[model samples]
Target: MSDLVSIPADAPTQGMEPNGWIVVGVPTNFFATASAHARSGPLLGAAAEVRFTPVGFRWDYGDGTSRTSASGGASWAALNLPEFSETSTSHVFEQPGTVSIGLVASYAAEYRFAGGEWRAVQGLVLVPTTPIIAIADRADTVLVAESCSINPSGPGC
Candidate 1:
């Protein structure tokens, strides 16, 4: 499966607060699925084919933090919740700057071809993790005397 398919690049990365805003200790999300294929070869013996499916992910938050998750993180809207209210994979940062985040997708494959019974692979295989993506977070300090509900103009609310 490793040689046949690569991890999808549509990994989720968003919910980041912009400059002048300080939203900390919040949950963000990411999502990626697997691709399937079956081709002709001796490996198949013209009697079998293979399918690779993403089972989970190991994530690097790039701030000396990492975690493994069973399901891809979802968007706030996808969960029908307000912004910053829910998450599947999340991180907390002490200070802010550019952070390098990455994901190593694990796959569980099965073989079924020529109308034969499906057989599961013994274990999971991981994709190469050399390539990674980065995100920037900003830190700001603001002094405000009013609340967003009352003032709706307070800084950093």
Candidate 2:
């Protein structure tokens, strides 16, 4: 019966607060965008439609750390929070390195056949989003004679 309906494996899109690079020991905000969609096909030898809706999200920070959230999370701008502010989907990198961060979206489905009432599909569909390659670096405070741009060759510059 489950084989009659098809759900899309299309992955979600992810965004980072800093746009690409993150800093160690600081919250790096993450967000995902997904939408409910329906597909039409044949089920039980009758015309049918299946709808998929996102219900949960799993975040894999790729540093041996992972978390699951009921919400996919929103951008800092969307949430009206300052950049680098802690969010439900934010994570703190403990060290400096290049890491692959990823998200897996879980979807609940409903199907209707021959214009009948919608029925639960009985299982969740898991789809992985495109991985984000982020470079985590440590921020250092240095006392220099002049700014790096102006000096170009001074102490820390």
Candidate 3:
């Protein structure tokens, strides 16, 4: 097969732990959500069906760092790990600022014409998800008389 597949696949979405405002020097988890999809189009004057299957995930931490993983990282609770624990797709920010986190899903494709047997495509389809912007900040530990939820204006609350 020629190393080409003109069909485009849907991009995956990115999910982050802590949602926003991550702590500096702490590991922040990231994950990707992707699924296989089928699309029908005209190929060489015949009806063709193309199916895309997600095979890889790539993460761009937007801090001059990136990583590729076979499986999308799961939540801390899902993984049974404590918060701030290191994960396969986690990234730690060294400074306090805003950064964009990005995810790209790579898909392998197969095609069939007129309900015939499926044929594997030679190359993968790369699709990028919308970047998620997050703020990185520092957190401090302070013992107080009451919890922050109880005392909104309390020190360090």
Best by lDDT: 2
> Number of clashes in every candidate structure?
0, 0, 0
User: Each candidate's lDDT (Cα)?
Assistant: 0.54, 0.82, 0.81
**If ranked by lDDT, best first, what sequence of candidates would result?**
2, 3, 1
Q: Candidate 3: where is the Cα deviation over 4 Å?
A: 1-7, 142-157
Per the 3 Å backbone cut-off, how many clashing residue pairs does candidate 1 have? 0
- Alpha carbon lDDT at 111, candidate 2: 87
**Candidate 2 residues 1-157, lDDT tens each?**
3663354545678898788898888899988987888888766676778888889899999899999998889998899775568899999999999999989999888888777899998879888877999999998764656787987654333
- Candidate 1 achieves a global lDDT of 0.54
For every candidate in turn, the CA RMSD to the true structure comes to 5.6, 6.2, 5.0
Off by over 4 Å in 1: 1-25, 33-47, 128-132, 141-157
Write candidate 3's Cα lDDT for 1-157 as tens digits. 2323445677777788878767888788898778899888765566788888999998888889899998877887888775667898898899989998888898888889888998988878788888999999888874668876887655444
Best first by TM-score, ranked? 2, 3, 1
Q: Per-residue error at 77 for model 1, in Å?
A: 1.3
Backbone clash pairs for candidate 3 read: none
lDDT of 2 at 136: 93
